[model samples]
Each structure stands twice: as structure tokens, then as C-alpha cells.
Target: MATPRPARAARVLLPALVAAALLGGCSTTVTGTAAPDPAPRPTEGVGADPVAWGDQVCGALLSYYQPLSARPDYAGADLPGIKDRLSGYLGNVRTGIDTGKQQLADAGASPVSGGDQFRTSIEDLLNRTGTTIDEARADVDQADPNDVPGFQERLQAAEEKLRTIGAAEGLDQLGATPRLDKAIAEAPRCGELDALTAPS
Candidate 1:
């Protein structure tokens, strides 16, 4: 069987890959199908239960990620078609990032100690990813579709920027705090994240 185009075209487009980092998974494999939406988790403020708090955090990130990974495939398409599809994919990514940020804000301050730091780290990662994707989208918009070499070069540059998505510090610290570690491990929604990132 052939490799999925989204994985083949750009691994950065997969939210499961990013979620692996967020949920403390060491690695991930891209699947062509999008993971099912996690059950409706509370959108309100953090609760005393660390598991509940973890659910809120995981929910916010997964909400947008579900749609973000359903990227358009450009395999075998002409240059013009490829350009359009690629641009659309990036635009969707930007929209997903915006939605995730707002959702995180709405989820309010974390109840667990050091949770705020963890949340901030995620926000920083999203900010950096958003900036890089936005820049790449802009470049794609200006690229001449007829110029195959130039378009390919632009895609390569975008891929390079995206390869650095999960390098944020707080992610590595997910296991550092026992409270958070338990929450992330036991949260219902977080379990979904684990399933999505697990090799399939």
C-alpha cells in the first residue's frame, strides 16, 4: 500500500504528531484517517481534580487537531492544483491554531501547581508553529504556480519550518510533575490523544 499523501507530502500537517509531544508520547505514525472527535469535555475552568484539569487541556488541543489533520491531498495533481490545495491546507492549519488558542484561553487557569507553566509552554509552541505556517502560507500565496522549481522550493522551506513543531520545553516536562503526569495519563480525553498518536 502507498503511504498517505499528507504524511508523504508533509509530516507537519498531522496533529497526531504534535499531540504525541503534548501528551508525552515519544513518537507517532501518521494515519490517513482522522481520529474520531473526543467526547465533549467541559469547556469551563479547571477543577480541583487533576484528571478533570487534564481533560480540559487535552480537549482544547484535540478539538482543533481533529480537523487540522484532515488535510487535502495533492498527489498526482498538476502544479496549479497542488498550489491551491497546499494553500488551503495551510490556511486550515492557521485557523485550527487560532481556534485552539482561544479554546485554551477559555479553559482558564489551571488548578494544579505548575500547570500554568505547562499551559504557557503549549501556547508558546502554538505561537511559534502559527508564525512559521503563516509565513509559509504567505510565500505560497506569492509563488508562481507555473514556476515548478520555485513552488517546490517554497514547499521544502515550509516543511523545514514545520519539522521543528514539537521542540518546546514544557512538553519534555510533562512527566516532571507527578500531579500533571497522573492527570495526563488518566484523563479520558487524554486517552484519546494517546490512541491517536500510538502506532497504527
Candidate 2:
């Protein structure tokens, strides 16, 4: 017996896919001094338990991403400052992702129903996200005003890849869970990203 091609691809490309999704750019102008926190919602539904668990994971992600989204334009800023800020932002994101994965594991949530794919996906995503963050920092260090267009292009590409993967993986369908759906919808920073990448 042989594994189906889609299964093989999912196994082989899971890391890359999750990484692309995590790195996908969701640009929004953050306002106010503080970002909104994830609110508590009732856990009720077919997958209510997992949905609740996933909310925590998503909350962790939003905390980091929301702040990063709020940061002023890094283009043409002091190179050293931009690099340092981006480095810090990436560090926070790394931490959040790790914590989110741990939370998911603790709750025994799986990307696929009754499968261990979520854990593997999170680990792979963390590793790749770290690398991407480093690369982004490097780009910042080397960036000039002329680099804006190229940088935007890269961001768009990453975002598109994430959107495609999310759709293929049925992440969009997860939004059917009321609580998780509301959390994502109300999230200040990740709202657009979640909408664009995850299924509605």
C-alpha cells in the first residue's frame, strides 16, 4: 500500500504551509495605546471544547501580532532601530507561537479531526517562523527607501500563500464555531488577517 499523493504532500509540506500562514502579512493600522484582549465566550457546539482551546491559542497569537501591527512604519526609519524593533517583535511572536502550541497540546487539539497533525504543524510553524523572522530582520537591517516595493511584494506573496493553505486545510471551516469565530472577528489586529487567511 502507498500513501495517497495529497496525504504525502500534506505530510511533506505541512511545515512549509504552516510557516507560510504564520508569516503571512496582515497589515492594519493599529490605534490607541493598548490592543484589545480576547474576550471570554461560551464553549458550546459540536467541537466546542476544541474551539475553546483554539481560542486561547489564537489569543496568544493576536497579542503579539496586534502590537506588531501597531508599530510605526519601519521604512526609512533608523536601520538599527528598525532591526532591533523587528527583532523584538519576532521574539514575541516566537514566544506566543510556542505558548499557543503548548496550550493546544495540553488541550489535545488536532488540525485534523482525531489526528495529531496540529502538534506537528505548530512545531514546524514555529521553526519556520523563527527563520522567517530572522530573515525579515536581516531585510530590515539592509532596507532602504527603495526597498519598500520589493518588501511589500514579498509580504503579499507570503500572505497569498497563507490564504491558499488555510483554505486547503479547512481552517476557514473552523470559523463556524461561534466563539472562535467571534474572537477572530473582534480581534483588533488579526481580524483582517484572519478573515483573509482563515475561512469565513
lDDT of each: 0.58, 0.39
What lDDT would candidate 1 get against the real structure? Answer: 0.58
Q: List the residue pairs that clash in candidate 1.
A: none
By summed lDDT, the worst window of 10 consecutive residues in model 1 runs over: 1-10
List of clashing residue pairs for candidate 2: 172-199
lDDT of 2 by residue, 4-74 (tens): 00112222232343243224323323232333324333254312344344444444444434433443344
- TM-scores of all predicted structures: 0.70, 0.40
Query: Stretches of candidate 2 above 4 Å error?
Result: 1-48, 72-77, 110-124, 138-200
Task: Give per-residue CA lDDT, model 1, range 1-200, as digits (tens).
Answer: 11101112124454332233222232223223333322233345565556777677766566545555666655566767766776787788788778878867866666655567677776786688789778877766776767867766666665566665553455544433555555666777766655544434
TM-score of 2: 0.40
Q: Residue 47, candidate 2: how far off, in angstroms?
A: 9.2
Cα deviation at 58, candidate 2, in Å, is 2.6
